[model samples]
Target: MSNIHVYSEIGKLKKVLLHRPGNEIDGVIPQTMPRHLFDDIPWKKGAQREHDCFADILRKEGAEVVYIEDLFRKSFSQKGSREGFIKKFLDKHGIFNPHLREQLEAYLLCLSPEEMADKIMSGIKKSDLGPKKQEDFSRFFPEEEYEHYYTEPLANLYYTRDPGASIGRGMSFHCMEKLGRNLETVVWQHIFEHHPDFAKDAPMWLSNESHFGIEGGDIAVFSKDVIGIGCGLRTRPEAIEQLAGNILPQDTFKKILVFTIPKDRKFMHLDTVLTMIDHDKFTIHPGIEATLNVFEISLGGSGELVYKDQTDKVEKVLTKALNLDSVQVLRCADGSFIDSEREQWNDGTNTLAIAPGTVVTYSRNEVTNELLRRSGIKVLEMPCGELSRGRGGPRCMSMPLVREDI
Candidate 1:
């Protein structure tokens, strides 16, 4: 009866969570794109169109797609919950100005729940309040500059995968590395804790309160008893160890494989450089293979931690982990150095698998898509000219809530 159940990466996806691009996309101006972790300013309308098509594809594949906004709005229905959430949200973001915080809360409470959700996600500007309030505020602190937003837009919320990962019959909330993305996990945490749909039965294996940074994009549920987490860039070794301590003790999870990937933005998360496409196959960027470092963590007989340094290559390590004799890896752009680099930058390896041998990817990664097809994998391609501006692809934008056991 658990609301969350994701045991394998390539299982038939039953339910998924997504966030359609909204006014938040417009908030990413060129001046702040770097701070927001966006490569370029995305065209708002075009991004929405691409995201809609992506959701449509999942629906066609028999997966039920849920929106983050809808669930969040529903979570606010309980009496006093909306006000409580607003206070916590403002406090967590360092809205310490007493008068400003009070005015903001009163202003937000004036809106309906749906509108409040929209405004919070889109951002509330200082100008939105009347000039009289701004004048009074300036009198209190003359040096404080008038800014565009009192609450910055949650631009990266659309990439639903980063806030948390759904494990076997449970979920793990992440402590995001980037300051801008920290609250993204808070939003989902509130929903999963208050929303009637998930609050009653959903299990939260990890909380987002850790000082050690971890991201959902780096956590991969490879099989029923094994998980692969990347420890570089967005995910830290300490966080992985924390996750291991929590998850390995569960009966459903027996071991965890930690892979050390390049600590670069282009390869920020594990799914950005490698993802499972089929039962025994993975689509990966060849650039990561040369320096791949694998480690194993499991529970000891006396309920303590047992660690090992794995000397085998990624394929060999995966083969042993999944109890398969061999594992196949499909290289991005068929191993062409320059072409692979270009496609990889566009998220060629970040493919989302809805079934055992099928995946969804960006149509812009033509070379990688063709390679997948030739390798006997069904490729469902979606346009990404605008959506790719966020530097994530199909896998990066989705969080599978329920998947059929393989």
Candidate 2:
């Protein structure tokens, strides 16, 4: 077993990993971007610039900003690693079209690590081929329209936080539920297993498998010894069980807290309702703090059992389990009716902490951000009009591997 570190959201981070938006945006047709869970198809170059700014912020703060593509390239350069990765991908997807598979393998091998990672994440363009070849290719396989079809790209790859969740000694790279998004997990596994910078130092556990599905967005590391898991559309109850089973035996974590939010499209994960700000302070929607039912599950000699006799409001439960006094709750504007509905639907409550008392959020959530700012929390704004179209906010875009002040 590797040394797994308990994450309390305030741990001093030495390094952080991020995936910047790539040409994958080009693969998303403007009409379908939202349904695929994106708002507007971002201009690749502009998105890159915006992402650079975010990276610069971290770099300026003295955290190492590791790029996903660089790690992917390093993994692909290793012979045994590349072959193992390609084999696993093809076998899992059941792609047996010999000639097509061979062609893709060759193309993949020819690409630099960055290009290969981009290709795997975004997909290769079919229309880029010459006209005569296109016509001949169409005829060669009547059923298949082009020489190669775009693998449904991992359009959500930029949201690294969804797959990287903290567990013992290291973090778990969650397997995605959506088949189209599976490639991102595959890439993560490759990087964790083969990337020189990460392979030796970073330990990873798999939470998503054929039978269980989990997403990182649904899990929150509230304290070094406590984890808050959100159960809803993206993560199954079984997945939660699997996580508890694997993590409980580890000495670092002492309790697993379960918060069941209404399974609405907007409340996709816990962060959608709750986020940690300063120590002992949290920003949450009133409904979640006051009404949601929270259960504390402890590991028993055999397995695990929920304390059926005791159930409490999320705030009280969290406060007791994590050993805190009071959690400062900030209500989004219009906490009564129409405005709350509109704001929550727009991901107004989802914010990511850069450091204690400092965070990033969507500027569009003016009332909510203002409330947070008035509370003495520094609110850094991202150009979210285009970003929000995808149904997630700042929290969704970032995947923090290390935070420096836990």
Candidate 3:
């Protein structure tokens, strides 16, 4: 009955959170692609169509899909929530000038809560504020600063998994590694703090206020008592230690498996290279097998922190952690290194499991999809010609809110 109840990756999903691609996707032009964390600009309509298909698959499987924007709007339904949200938004992202801050606040407050929520996510351009004489900003910014056109857009928001993750009856709000994505968690913070349905009971495992970087994509719950966190480009060891300290002693969790992966954009997060598809089976990109290092964290008998450096292979690590007799490591593209590299770049290993042996992935990764099917997994594929432009697949775009314990 809890709002957040994800216990395992392959559980029967009951509810999930997603964000439809909006004008935010359109804001990614060539000049801003790197800053926005996109490799290419996605066609807005095509991206929306793809995202819709992704949602449709979840619905067909009996999972209730909720949009981040809708949840955010509901969070502001109270009398003064909108005003408070707008102030927080401006304080972190608005211009420093008092006059401009007042103008932006007035503009945002005039809109309905739903419209304001969309506007904030879509971003505010200087042009939206009407023509300001150069003199107006001359005192606040140098001549070179004028080249920056607008407030940073939440372009990466559609990959809703990075902002926060749903653990067992609780959620871990992240401090995203990049400036463009960090604000995304603020939206989640607002929803979890003010939305009546969620705010009433859901517990928070980690707060976004942490100085160290951590992302939802890097955290995966394997079972009720086990969690695997990737310490790589987007997640820091300090944050992982902090999360383990907070979660291990109090929750059902007994051990936190920490994977130190290659810190490269190509291997951005653990989910991008590895994900549990079934109780004893995992889908992994072969590219990372050579560089991956594993560790374990748990609480001692006296509630003191305990750490162990793992020496077994990744498969062995999982087998012992989950108490399984054996584990299957399904290589992406069935071990075709060249093909695996290409497909992994397109998120071949990022599969979202709605139930044991059932997953949703990008249709473009034909080799990987076929491999999953050959391994007795039900693979549902979604069109991702546009969605893949963002370099994420099904799992990266979804955050399971509730799942029946496996």
Candidate 4:
């Protein structure tokens, strides 16, 4: 087996990828908060502190923690990696004019690999691209478009799980639905294709170069052969079905459970509304307790897929998926209507299970975290005063890269 296996959500995490809030936060303008996918801005320094504590806890638990910035730095250290990345990065943002692209490349290439990576994440100013030539051409409509940057900083890159996911021995590099997040996956593609530690072990099962949108936060492995994906705001149902196309032929994964949740940003991705905590236990927001749409998909004979409508009650479907007689669905905020709503909005249910029955959650979600503890689960709390502003909890911040199959 490769070092990238993640056959189940509650597997023992051996290694994970995280991004510490960096200059991207500094580049966030009030005008761009919505574009950045942030309801409110995070205090970068405090968010960093909290992120450090999060990584420290994982390291203390024996999980090797890899970081985004470090990976990009290493990946760009190859002979012509920086120059190649600059061309693609500029071209992606619609800087098609030859002279403009050359100036942008020159500006970016002036930095070392480390600074080049950071600069791209932090964003380059419009003035930094140099004055546009008279012959510059663009498809952007005159009044409706153009900005200070050919490409804006990917502020949401810190939420590492949204770009891609690890499925058993393979990884799905997502095509993010939001333009603000698209380049984030580009950075991941480069690292996945070039980074020494990940290149060999993590095979690309899907890439955004040509595919529908699927975010890592919406994907969870139920077992080697069974997996669950959220058809949420950021993930399209077509994407999940297409992903099924990529995996169903292999013996490693045979079934996919697609949970179609509301398109509202509050329940943005699956992890925000539900998370697996144990072999037969889950933490879910009361808001989605009774109304989630479920569908079962599996490979049929002769390269066809079979589909079936599933029970609306997630607990019933999960029991069957995990082969358990019954599964426990614990409500966030302990069944209180108002508190549950508030905590769910605060990502109280978005817990990260590092191992069975153990999870990392935000300390501010006191009501929900307390309830998780009373249910015989070990809830490790991390400060999130600033981090929560991004509308994600622990699970949204980390992506498991190596896990021991339970």
**Clash count per candidate:** 0, 16, 0, 0
Model 1, poorest ten-residue lDDT window?
138-147
lDDT by residue for model 4 over 306-361, one digit each (tens)?
A: 89999557888888787889988899998899999899888998999999999999
lDDT of 3 by residue, 18-129 (tens): 9999988777888788878889888999999989999999999999999998888778877788888776666556367776777788778888888888888988777677
Best by lDDT: 1
Instruction: Give the poorly placed runs of model 1, Cα more than 4 Å off.
Output: 131-146
In candidate 2, stretches whose alpha carbon ends up further than 4 angstroms from where it belongs are 1-6, 12-14, 30-35, 92-94, 127-148, 207-210, 287-291, 301-310, 334-336
Give, for candidate 4, the lowest lDDT window spanning 10 residues: 138-147
Per-residue CA lDDT of model 2 for 10-42, tens digit only, reads 454446667888766666776556535765666
Candidates 2 and 3, the one with greater TM-score: 3
Residues 328-389, model 1: lDDT tens digits: 99999999999999999999999999999999999999999999999999999999999998
Per-model TM against the reference: 0.96, 0.87, 0.96, 0.94
Range of the 10 consecutive residues with the lowest summed lDDT in candidate 2: 127-136
Please give the RMSD of candidate 4 to the true structure: 2.3
Candidate 1 structure, TM-score to reference: 0.96
Looking at model 3, residue 142 earns an lDDT score of 47
